[model samples]
Target chain A: MDERERSEMETRARLVAAYDAMSPSAEVTDRVLARLRDDARVPEKKRKSVEPDSRSALRFGLFLLPLAACVVAAAILLRPSAMMPTATKVSQEEVVVEETVDAASSDAAVAGDASVEVAEEAEGLAPQATKSEAAEADAAAGAESREPLCELYPIVVTPEGRELRVGDVYAGKFDDVRPEESVAFSEDGKRSVACELIERDGALFVRYGDSADWRFAS
Target chain B: MAIDLEAVFRRHFATVYRLCYSYLGSASDAEDAAQSVFLKLLNHPREFADSEHEKAWLIVCASNHCKDELKSARRTRVVSMGERLDASLGATDHLDETIDAVLKLPPKYKDCVYLYYYEGYKTAEVADMLGIPASTVRNRLRKARALLKDSLGGS
Candidate 1:
């Protein structure tokens, strides 16, 4: 407000004069000093407890907040859903995956069970084909040897709340994946059922049960 | 070392008493409120940065205490300037009337009016002392002046 200060008015002067005339009576000062002296014996620690304020509580709550966030993040991070995809290739013979080529058009599984036999056949050193044919067989064996590994995290909405748990880790390529699918939304495995891996547009997807919608692996 | 209570009491007793009196408009009750504020200072001692900080803390506490005393059920209608101050002013009509009018204004407005008019503090200085924004102090003073205009008579 740009209003002019009403300084020179008689009312202001009168107010100034009246308040100027007043002072704390001697009786009040004596009483206050006496009271302070009488109570000064108590320790500061004891005095603080008697008069509690919200500032300490507010500070404590603020301090614990970041720690709480870190704990929750750690818990979530420990689950495989937060794990970044690693490019550690497993040779075909070293892997113990049970492969099947069921529902050939829809199922996306790397059915490289022929890889072991093909390796053995190539190693036998029997005269079977021309050099061109040997090259074709070696090429086919190489394609079946290295399959990328993928893991999935499936969640189901339950009565309590949404739960995120590791479904299973499967070793397969986007070209094909066939694994025995099972799930337990709770302690009991009631929700566990058959699932089929589907490949579409170069991304691996899974469909659990007949009624469940096809979901992309995350 | 702890603050020198005797010196502080001597220096600030009147200013605190004056502020409480402005809000409460009664000498005896203002005494009680002022005592309570200083008692708080004694009970819970704080490390002050400077003399201004010490004085500001007392003034703010006294203001809060006076507002509380007025809000408490024991306080009824605000007491007028009455015979004690009137005789002290030698029966000055305008000052007595203005003092009474200022006491009638709410404590929020009364704080600015008292600090600005009697204490001779600038608006920004009053805001710093009261721990409020300067604009808020100015707004309160404007409203307080408007309230006092009836008795102050447009001037």
Candidate 2:
């Protein structure tokens, strides 16, 4: 070997010798072992296998309550319109006739001395009553214009029984109503009663406001 | 499955303690760090993948802990130069002079010298253990040898 290599080897040897001569502490192993044993024994209670059944049951019940509530809330939000029914429909022609007759009676009552003259005029022109007819038609048209637009369709109350209709008059109550669905009334049934219509999930529901239940709107 | 802590302690305690002592140059700190190492093993016994892994981890952990203690001691001004010199000397005569020369060398050179000679690690193994490039280890070792030779009166 070269002198440099020899010198390096000698240095390594001397350092190793110095290290070997120095003794380690005698109690180090004992101290380490004691600590390990202490660690293994602590927390013994947490490792026990026999927990009480009642405590476990209580924990399980608590966990399931929130899960059950979440399922119910999801169901309600997904099907909001399945809660009510639609209102009855009123025809514009009938409303106009009723307003015309009422206006004529009021006019006769106010024109007290002219009442005889108006009645005579009414009788003679009852047959050729073109002028009166035109006046009645105008009056009917004005009354129809004054009626609320929401009164044309059924009103739908929310599932919480809150009124969902836009009109002031309540149409009717409905059962199992859903939002966005249309309701149809029977041919002979009164079409003017306020009905609650709930539309949900591409289907319409109709029910009367006074009733406790709803039917699918046809 | 839980590890056989007693068996592991019995098998490697001496080596681990010795490694810590060499790193810290103090018996008290070595013992404390050694105990801490075993305590850590007890808490998380499944960390080691195999026997070799466990041994390597213990050495690394103990070494790191000892270095931290040394840093704290220095910061607190509790690390007396005379005491360190005496501890490094142990039973060796004229160790003060030898260590003074070693200490005068740069820290990188000193680490290579101490691990190679004082700790009895091979150059390649020391390189792997310290996570340094092997060429760097070679250069440090060469530089330390030159410095030591000059200090020790070698031509």
- TM-score leader: 1
Q: For candidate 2, give the lDDT of residue B4.
A: 78
Q: What is the DockQ of candidate 2?
A: 0.17
Q: Is the docking of candidate 2 incorrect, acceptable, medium or high quality?
A: incorrect
- TM-score of chain B, candidates 1 onward in order: 0.87, 0.63
Clashes of each: 5, 44
Candidate 2 Cα outliers beyond 4 Å, as residue runs: A44-218, B1-3, B47-50, B73-75, B81-90, B94-115, B118-121, B146-155
Best by DockQ: 1
Give the i-RMS of model 2 in Å: 7.4
Candidate 1 residue runs with Cα over 4 Å from true position: A1-12, A25-218, B1-3, B77-91
Predicted candidate 2 versus true structure: per-residue lDDT over A1-218, tens digit per residue: 99878866777665665445333544546766765676577674542322347746766877888999999878986763434322222233234334544555466567554444443333232322343353344343343433322233444454558654333333344454544343333322433433445654445555432222455544
lDDT of 1 by residue, B1-155 (tens): 13487678778888888898787777777776776787788777787898778888898999998887777544566455463363434545655666667667888887788788887889999988888999999899778777777656765
